[model samples]
Target: METITKIVTRFGGVSLLPVAVALLAFVLIGAPSSWVTLTIAGLAMGMMIFLMASGLSLVFGLMDVMNFGHSAFISFGAFIAASVLAGLSGWLGSDLIILNIAALFLAFAAAILFGMAAGWFFEAVIIKPVYKDHLRQILITMGALIVAEQMILALWGGAPMTVHRPQFLEGSFLIGDITIEVYRAFAFMLGLAVYVALYLTLNRTRIGLLIRAGVENREMVEALGFRIDRLFVGVFMLGSALAAMGGAIWAGYETLITPALGGEMMIVVFIVVIIGGLGSIEGTLLGAIMVGLMANYVGYLAPKLALTSNMILMMVILLWRPNGLKPAVK
Candidate 1:
């Protein structure tokens, strides 16, 4: 095993795990029909995980801050989405089916605004105070998470809030013999659009380029007369907005909103981010894709041990590369 580890490490630990995943997938997909179904499911899951981790990557990259409360923002977005949809349904005098369009639009807006609110608060009070102190940010955000949780409980009660699929989005879309949920299809498209737009912004736009450069050397960028403080605001806001969008989509998928949703999702997000790298956007996307597929397949193989797959991957990656699969060195 040690010799095997040394051989794999020589080529980069990142390649080793993914290579393992590929072989496992190849084995599982020996049958054509089952393989196609699994592939579609994996693709759909990968899209959402990518978006979720993208936000986390951006924030961590520029700010050198670990937003432990990001999961709370996700919960905030989900509940806000549910509340908006419910309100829209009431206004239309129709069921969930009748109001999906307007409901989704409003939910998107609500999630963005709520996410911005979380970012602003975090940046001003908690995050700002802990400049180079990751421990402080973690502690403070954990406290904020508790308060946020309690407040949610007070406002919405402890019962789970279920959202019914809009009439148009209720049924599954059958492509041949495989049935795919209409909403998952919608989420996948949205996720792709978001990823493309974000990727372009990071790679093409001037602001995006500056952010990338800054992530490489914050002090250098600052010394070069770039307006880093303003850029930080933009980065934080953008990350938060992405987080909210992901939350709204997630709410649509599950059709239920709970205060604990963020906490539960947080574990996965953390695993994805850590496995991918601390400050690498591309790493986030790749890690998300692997985790998403691993999760679904793990559940199929061992329902009780599903969550362990993600954490186990993260542990293996950390042992091999302490900085992660992709660290923002360039």
Candidate 2:
């Protein structure tokens, strides 16, 4: 085990996991074009999931909060973005690209803003009292989730709402034997961009330094006149906003959403968090990408095992490294 860890570390550690998985899949599939298509789709799926899971990773990993209601932000974001796009159908279908872009921006912005506000409220009202109590945190968050679902049903109703794509985002880019959807490409780029931004913010910025410090020694940071509580609130809000953005993107990817979207996604989101390890952005990204690639490859090669592939992957990874591929240092 020690020798294998050293070998993996020498070869860029777990960052090479996605590439390794791809290589193995390529050999098994034996078709370059199909392989390429599936690979792109998998990456896109992974990115979207990363967006949803990243925040929860921080909330659970760093803040030590078990927020089962985190999915509420996802559900609200999807519904809100869908509603905005629905209201801006004319702009979405317009011949003008600027209008389409504006509409798209507005939809995502609304989702993010709502997520931030709702997160603040949730943290202040429900989560604040439950700190350091995992059992109550779970019970309260679950209750909050139930209420959120009810609220969503009351507002969006029981119908499945169709999400609209912008004019510029519609269609596919054909390259010889392979056809790649423009939306998928956009999603990949957006997710990659978000990951880079988050990496820089958490690893490079002053605010990130404080957050990490607080996690390590809250008493010292507090004694230094830093408001640890406010910092945590900000962290919670940021996490919620990220989830909302992810949900908004996912809504476009699915093109149709129902009130039960959050409930359905909760399991997958939790899986990604657990797979990535707590409090590590890099780990979360790695875990999400692995799940994405595994799901797509398995679905294509063995349809019957598609649903269980992630669970299997999680088990294997845990058995190999119980703390996950790259857990953040405490």
Number of the top-ranking candidate, with lDDT as the measure:
2
Candidate 2, residue 72: Cα displacement in angstroms equals 0.5
The regions of model 1 sitting more than 4 angstroms off are 1-23, 90-99
Candidate 1 structure, TM-score to reference: 0.89
lDDT of 2 at 95: 98
Candidate 1's residue-wise lDDT over 1-330, tens digit each?
467667767877654565567568758656555555655566577777777668888888888888888777778888888888777766334565436567667778988988887787777877778878988888988988888888889988999998655567667777777768777777778878887887788889988888888877888888989978788877887777778778777887888778898888888888888878766787887787788778777776667888688888788778877777777663
Top TM-score: which candidate number?
Answer: 2
lDDT of 2: 0.92
Give the poorly placed runs of model 2, Cα more than 4 Å off.
none
Location of the lowest summed lDDT over 10 successive residues in candidate 1 = 91-100
